[model samples]
Target: MIIQMEGISKSFSGNQVLKEVAFSLEKGEIHALMGENGAGKSTMMKILTGIYARDSGTVEVKGKQVVYKGPKDAERDGIAVIHQELNILPELTVAENLYLGNEQTVGKTAWLKTKEMNRKTEETLRDLGLHVKATERAGNLSVGKQQMIEIAKALMTNADVIIMDEPTAALTDREIQTLFKTIRGLQEKGVSFIYISHRMEEIFSLCDRITVLRDGQYVGVKNIPETSFDEIVSMMVGRQLGGRFPELTNEPGDVKLEVKGLTRMGEFKDISFAVKSGEILGISGLMGAGRSEVVETLFGYRKAESGQILINGKEVQISSPIEAIRNGLGLITEDRKTKGLITDFSIRENISLANLKSISTNGWIAKKKESALFENLIKRLRVVCSSPEQQAKSLSGGNQQKVVIAKWLGTSPSILILDEPTRGVDVGAKKEIYTIMKELAEQGVAIIMVSSELPEVIGMSSRVMVMFEGQMKTILDRNELSEEHIMHYATGGDKHVG
Candidate 1:
């Protein structure tokens, strides 16, 4: 085995995050670590990467037991990690960022060998199938491209054990395929990986073994060929999930939101849609099909050159997020880390962020009232945390997303827009979110959901609106929605609606 962790245990402020978790990886193997949010998968990886010291147990790398004082120590011992959050310095050029701590120096002068670094970075980028130039500023690249740079940085270490956390979250299909190919190539050279992701298909297709963790305890491990999808899910969630989506029980009512000729120049053009109270209107399309742009415009993040927005049969101008909120509209943005929650703030602060006015009096916050409100929201949303005072960044990705939802829910908006609501969430958490949406819809909240996952859109939406190149291609009823039809319209093919 290249790496083996036995009886690994850890805790934080009386909250046990891991309990006797055992994991192993063979040389050249891609091992999957599966768990719901706060399930200790990330915690275990942090321990192995030397970000946190394990409270108990043993970690052996390459048949030798050694204790790493920090990430530098781990790296020195042939280990590297690509965190879920990008850690590159955006201000630096790609080549400079890649060689950050280990710059090549010229002949005892301590001068940087800039040309040599750039040459090597260019070679690494090309080998990783990235088109980005080594001299390009890291901040200017797209999130997907930046992710590739992170991979390249890890590979530059020549580490035998690489830990990846949700590495494909921001990648397109082509980029994902390229990444898998790269992994396969590296595996042939005896480089092993400990992979973590919420996407089950990726786990099955790319991993050799699966390890399940639940509520900070080790569940079990199975070889990919010997285990079924259902079995792995049951292990992670601690129960059997009956279906992919919750049953929709709400029926459509009067139109709660209406848009006409919404245009934003090159972004989207002449788009129009109506979402009725108690109905889920799903917007589906390719990644760059302007779905997020349209929703952002509606939420007042972008200005629409010419358009009409009608809420409850009355035309209104929402030129800012405050106006949108005052008009009973809420938006859960696509990038949760950047747009949704304030990572450094407490959960209580984030929940009240959207509706501070309601919980305040005469420009002063009502402390008791605020605490009560946040406590209620935290319980209702099932945001698992040590306390409401816990920093938002300390929670798992799923819990962080729930806090975003709770923040918007606190506003009590009549129309709620969720863009890529379950992008990086686990399957169990996805179901919980679906249930929350259903309950909200049942209470007469009009929902407009934008999702790239076809199955989610088909299962939860009352009607699916397909967009292509900033144009509204067609709208399909539930019966007419299919992966093939959605892709056809998304790719500028003929619109077919039943």
Candidate 2:
């Protein structure tokens, strides 16, 4: 075995997160770690990477028992981790970020060997099939590109065992293919990987063995060839998920929002669509197909060069987020960590931020009313947190998403625009979010959702709109929705359907 952890236990403020969990990885093997958010997957991995010390356990690397004091120590012992959240400094160049702490020095002086570092960074990027320049600013690159840089950083360590947490969450399908190729190449070179991802397809395709964790306890491990996807999901969720999406009973009502000839030059042009009250209009397309751009225009985040927006059959001008909110429109942005929530603030503060006017009287805040509002939202959304005062960043990815939903729900908008609502959440959380959308639709709120996952779009949408190369290819009804059909239009294979 390349790595083995047994009888691991950990807790935070008397709340047990992991309870005697056991895991093992073999040399040159791609092992999958499956779990829902807050299921102790991150905690277990953190312990392995020396970010957290286990309360009780034994960790052995290559048959040698060792305890690392920090991440550097773990890296020295041939273990490296690519965290879910991007960890590169925005101010630094790609090469600088890659060799951050382990910089090359010239002749024992404090001066750095800039040329050597850039050359090594270029070599690593080329090896990984990433087309980013070593001297380019990290912040200027797209999320997908930044993700590649993170992988390159991990590979630079030359570790025998690597832990990847949601490594492809921000990547496009093409980038994902490149990553898979890289993983296979590394495996051929005798490097092992502990892959953590919620996407079942990725696990089934890349992993040799799968280990399940639930509520901070080890469930079981199975060989990829012997176990089925349904069985794995049942183990992680502790119950059968009856369906991928809930059945919609509520019918769409009269038009609540309509966009006509919305144009943004190169981003998107002549975009037109209408969403009725109690309807979910799904926007589906490939990455950079201008889905986000169109939605941002509707939400007042981007200026529309020429367009007409009508709410309740009356034209309204929405030039900013504040204006959109005041006009009864709410947007749940795609990138939740950076664009949606204030990570440093408490849950109560975030939930109350959107609708401050409703919770305030005479320009003075109403403390009791605010507390009551937050309490109700917390219980309604099933957000798992110790208290309302807990920082938003402290919650798991699933819980943070719920908080984002709650923040918008607080505004009591008639139209809600959700962009990749369940992007990084778990299946259980996805189900809960779908349920919430259904409930909200039943309450007469129109929903316009933008998603990259075709299953999600087809399953939840009343109608799916396909976009290709910044133009509307087709709008598919429920009866016409299928992965092949959607992809055909999204990839510009067909443009005549409506």
lDDT tens digits by residue: candidate 1, 371-396: 88888888887888878788998888
| Worst lDDT 10-window in candidate 1 | 169-178
lDDT of 1: 0.88
Query: Which regions of candidate 1 fall more than 4 Å away from where they truly are?
Result: 93-99, 102-137, 140-145, 496-498
What range of 10 consecutive residues in model 2 has the weakest lDDT sum? 169-178
Checking candidate 2 for backbone clashes, the offending pairs are: none
TM-score for each predicted model, relative to the true structure: 0.90, 0.92
Q: How do the residues 71-146 of candidate 2 rate in per-residue lDDT, one tens digit apiece?
A: 8888888899998877879889999999998899988899999998998898888876676788999997756678
| Alpha carbon lDDT at 415, candidate 1 | 95
